[model samples]
Target: MALMITDECINCDVCEPECPNDAISQGAEIYVIDPNKCTECVGHYDTPQCVEVCPVDCIPKDPDHAETQDQLRAKYEKLVAAKG
Candidate 1:
C-alpha cells in the first residue's frame, strides 16, 4: 500500500529526504506523500525509509490507495523507466 502522512505529523522535515521516489513534499501544513509516486520502498529498500525515519510515526498505509507488493514493484519500475 502507498503510505500517507497523517495530520499528526510534526513537520520536523525528516521524512521528505528519506523518500527514494521523491514523493514527499511540503504541504501548507504538513509534509504530504504523493500516492502515485509512493511504493513503500518496495523496489528501493526492505522498509519505507520515510516511515523508518519519521519521528512522529505519522506515516501509515493509505487505505484509499491500497496496493499489493507486486503492484508497488510495478509502480517502482514504471517510475524508474520514466526517469530514463
Candidate 2:
C-alpha cells in the first residue's frame, strides 16, 4: 500500500529526504505523500524509509491506494523509466 502522512505529522522535515520515491512533500502544515509516486519503497528499499524515520509515527498505509507488491514493482519501474 502507498504510505500517507497523517495529521499527527510534526512537519519536522525528516521524512521527505528519506523517501526514495520522492513521494513526500511539505504541505501548508504537515508533510503530504503523493500516492501516485509512493511505492512504500518497494523497489528501492526492503521497508518504507519515511515510516521508519518519522518521529511521530504519522506515516501509515493509504487504504484507498492499496496495491499488491507486484503492482508496486510495476509502478516503480514506470517511475524509473519515466525519469530516464
Candidate 3:
C-alpha cells in the first residue's frame, strides 16, 4: 500500500528526499505522498524510508490506495522505466 503523511506531520522536510520513488512532496500545509509513485519501498528497501525517517510517525498506509506487494513491485518497475 502507499503511505500518506497525515496532519500530524511536522513539516520537518526529512521524508521528501528519502523516498526512492520521489513520492513525497510539500503540500500547502504538510507533506503529501503520491500514491501512483509510492511503493512502500518494496523495490528499494525492506522498509518504507519515509516512515523510517519521520519523527512524528505520521506516515501510514493509505486506505484509499490499497495495493498488494505485486502491485507495488509493478509500480516500482514502471517508475524506474519512466526515469530512464
Candidate 4:
C-alpha cells in the first residue's frame, strides 16, 4: 500500500527528505504523499523511511490506493526508468 500523511501531521518537515521516491511534500497544512510516486520504499529499503522517521506517527497505509508489494516494485521501476 502507498502511505499517506494524515491530518494529524505536525508539518515538521521531517518526512519529506526521508522519502526515497520524492513523494512526500509540504502541503498547505501538512505533509502530503503522492500515491503515484509512493512505493513504500520497496526498492530502496526494507521499510518506509518516512514512516520510520515520522515523529507523530501520522503516516499510514493509504486504503484508497491499496497496492501489493509486486505492484509497488513495478511502480518503483517505472519511476527509475522515467528518471533515466
| Poorest lDDT segment (10 consecutive residues) of candidate 1 | 51-60
lDDT of 4 by residue, 9-81 (tens): 9888888988989998888888899999999999899999998998899999999999999999999999999
Candidate 3 least-lDDT 10 residues? 19-28
- For 1-84, candidate 1 gives per-residue lDDT tens digits of 899999999999999998999999999999999999999999999999999999879999999999999999999999999999
Clash count in backbone of candidate 2: 0
How many backbone clashes are present in model 3?
0
Score candidate 3 by lDDT.
Answer: 0.94
Give per-model TM-scores. Answer: 0.98, 0.97, 0.97, 0.98
Model 2, range 5-79, lDDT digits (tens) per residue? Answer: 899988898999998888889888889999999999988999999989888898889999989999999999999
Q: How close is candidate 1 to the true structure, as a TM-score?
A: 0.98
Q: Per-residue lDDT tens digits of candidate 3, residues 18-51?
A: 9999888899999999999999999899999999
**What lDDT score belongs to each candidate, Candidate 1 first?**
0.95, 0.91, 0.94, 0.93
lDDT of 2: 0.91
Candidate 4 lowest-lDDT run of ten: 24-33
Q: What alpha-carbon RMSD in Å does predicted model 4 have with respect to the real structure?
A: 0.5
